[model samples]
Target: MPATTVLRPRSRTLIIAATVPLALAALLADDVRVRRQLDAVPPDPTSSRTDSTTLVPASS
Candidate 1:
């Protein structure tokens, strides 16, 4: 197996410089898409309440 070598300062700097902007841009884009979807959806009044009952009464 080859010995692991740590990245040099310049290579590390270049990697961070390239990746950070892309990561931030992707995050911002996802936020924008979610906001748009939320805005486009009409609110449903039925979704505000749940009527499910879990009780099982003993049969007489």
Candidate 2:
């Protein structure tokens, strides 16, 4: 079993092979998160709720 085999520090190949899926899954999850964030709509600058922290850019 990879669970027990991965715990053995002596077998470097087994450890690397077993952990490959975990690494790929992490990468895929991060990619999906970034794509979703990129597709998200930007906030409206003309909203009436005057928050000073949200500054509008000048054309100057």
Q: Give the number of the best model, judged by lDDT.
A: 1
Q: Looking at model 1, which ten-residue stretch has the lowest summed lDDT?
A: 48-57
lDDT (tens digit, per residue) of candidate 1 on 1-60: 356888889999999999999999999999999888876877666764343233456699
Q: What is the C-alpha RMSD of each candidate to the true structure, in Å?
A: 9.6, 8.1
Task: Kindly list the per-residue Cα lDDT of model 2 for residues 1-60, writing each as its tens digit.
Answer: 555554556677788888999999999999999878865846558876465356787798
Off by over 4 Å in 2: 1-10, 43-60
TM-score, predicted candidate 1 vs. hidden true structure: 0.65
Q: Please give the lDDT score at residue 7 for candidate 1.
A: 83
Shift of residue 60 alpha carbon in model 2, Å: 25
Every model's TM-score: 0.65, 0.49
